[model samples]
Target: MGRPAIEVQGLWTQFGNQVVHKDLTLAVQRGEILGIVGGSGSGKTTLLRELIGLQPPSRGRVCILGEDIQRLSAAEQRRLSQRWGVLFQQGALFSALSVFDNIAFPLRELRTLDEASIRDLVMLKLRMVGLRPADALKMPAELSGGMVKRVGLARALALDAELLFLDEPTSGLDPVAANAFDELIGHVRDGLGLTVVMITHDLDSLATVCDRVAVLADQRFIAVAPLAEVVQLAHPFIRDFFHGERGDRVLRAAAQPASSPGGA
Candidate 1:
């Protein structure tokens, strides 16, 4: 279709003698949520890190918003960072900072906006994530796991970024809370028209929020159009993940299409 918001072609990442990704290629369209799933140590996080410029890939290209990030000048890279936001595992909020401060941290660092403007923006973001104004004043440690995740989400939206990256957004929450979080992701993406790249273990989240998913296996990510197609992947890790013993029924139900009673 249109030019992709993020494109990774022939990406290869390595750690000493260990190769994490080999000839991996994928692309994320604008204003769409792309979920990445794989077993632990399958290099999902490694892929995300390289995409964000935290680590250099051994080979290949990453083009975000039409520019190769790895070849950019330092100033250009900084500018690119401002246009994107990330939520790491564990919410990664500053333990010492209040939730309000944590949310405002990015705005304070990147923008010329004054205190009043910053507060207004921060409050808006917090509210978007279903957090009350009063909740922002509390220390991050005082928040529940779900609340902390919301706060982290608020912070990621602080800059009004065009692109967002979430690493295991549902890692610590219970099933109910995780479902709620997935709904929130859907709402936020629609409300903001932002492209999302999420690395998630939660299959329900994939069915709920993702426009498409890429399964990482055998050192490459295979893009699958729908959850049903993904479920049929022949790779051991892919099959084990999509149709694993623990929750096959739920996945099957989630992937099923609704049918009418009368025959056509």
Candidate 2:
């Protein structure tokens, strides 16, 4: 097989006396969705920052699409960054910009497309994320929780990025909306042939769209495998997370046939 889309080796993160990651490593294959889950304060966000070059690891190597991010020059890094997109937990839309302008932000930054072309591409992205053209005129403040996520997703795909990073993609939505968002993620990934790495605590999302799930604990990834296989591990966190009341409910729901829209 070819090199993985993302690869981390001997990673370590430290903040003064506190060490966040210790010899952590992982690999994400091309065109697959990998879910990252960890308990509170497990440094999931920190790891993500390092992976995307927002923050540097104390000692490690991070490679994305075969380039070592830490070794890249500024111009090279900027060019490489355009190959991937990120969706922050709260959608992180520009408060002052309308939906149209928000989705157009990245494209405009490229300074390559004219206004007419930008408009056409923005509309296409909006449609790809299941939003209406008229909705593009609305401000971020006017959007619902689900709408915010959809808009964030649309912007994430605006660059036609080969890799997508999602921080808590399905948080703050009702079960139905979250499920719908998960379906949209799967649809978008397959349609765009994108490799996705998402940090999510939503079990329903893991069960629904993730090709593999990675658990972070004890300052490293404890297990990275399919949900069923990971759940079978002897780790305490795995047991509590997958066999607990909430986990059991989600697992049961996932095992059965697709339920009606009214179901959680």
Candidate 3:
């Protein structure tokens, strides 16, 4: 908590008369994985969009690395963008570009690296995400949903960003695939010492990866401690979400005392 890597103070966003976010404030520490969760239409994505400069907050301040992004000059903002990376929710890959080009896109646009160096860098990023060098030459359409997401992740790392934002990285994948993707995220963050801010509905991720979780509720974010504590919350939506219809049986078993040799 030594001066948050990302800070938001009194943030607000609106769509005409509709208020998406209000009086929102949050601080994310460097190298920490922070998870955001909320019901649909809760402005979770809106908050991320505002934080990353995709959309301006209707009011308030967003500071990253001690600089207010909204106040920065165009060139200054572009320069700051180089230090952060984003993976959109749906694996927003360029349909026409090959995976190699997609992964190299950020580096080529932001840096003055030569073609040879860019290729080397792209290949390294692809391999880091478990994709083979040969796979880099293939187009996005040729890859499966899971592979496409991994390629998007590789692209996010191309800029050598200190902060990474992933929007539903595990969505639409099978359970096993999603679990593998989660492990990859943890591994990548550890290997790169990256600070991750993710928006996810997956409780498993909260338990397995996130350092802290913030729930969007009543137009503000409230930090929930451990995954179990989050599960025990009294909010109707929170309880229904974490303890789905079938989850009650599991919870009861989990709460029950251990069996003894001569149970009464």
Q: How many backbone clashes does candidate 1 have?
A: 0
Q: What is the TM-score of each candidate against the true structure?
A: 0.93, 0.95, 0.91
Runs of candidate 1 with Cα error greater than 4 angstroms are 253-264
lDDT of 1 by residue, 82-185 (tens): 88889998999999999999999999996698999999999999999999999988998798999999999999999988899999999989999999999898
Q: What is candidate 1's TM-score against the reference?
A: 0.93
Residue pairs whose backbone atoms clash in candidate 2: none
Task: Encode model 3's per-residue lDDT on 1-264: one tens digit a residue.
Answer: 466789999999888999888899888888778889999999988888887888899999999978899999988988988899899988999999999999998888866999999999999999999999999889999999889999999999998888899999898988788888988988888888888899999766766677767888878875545454566778877776768865665345434442111101
RMSD of each: 4.4, 4.2, 6.6
Best by lDDT: 2
> lDDT of model 3 at residue 242?
69
- Candidate lDDT scores, in order, read 0.85, 0.90, 0.83
Which portions of model 2 miss their true places by more than 4 Å? 252-264
State the lDDT of candidate 2 residue by residue for 1-264, as single tens digits.
578999999999999999989999899988888999999999999999998999999998999999999999999999999999999999999999999999999999999999999999999999999999999999999999999999999999999999999999999999999999999988888788889999999998888788788999999999997776777789888887888768776676556543221100
- Would you give me the overall lDDT of model 2? 0.90
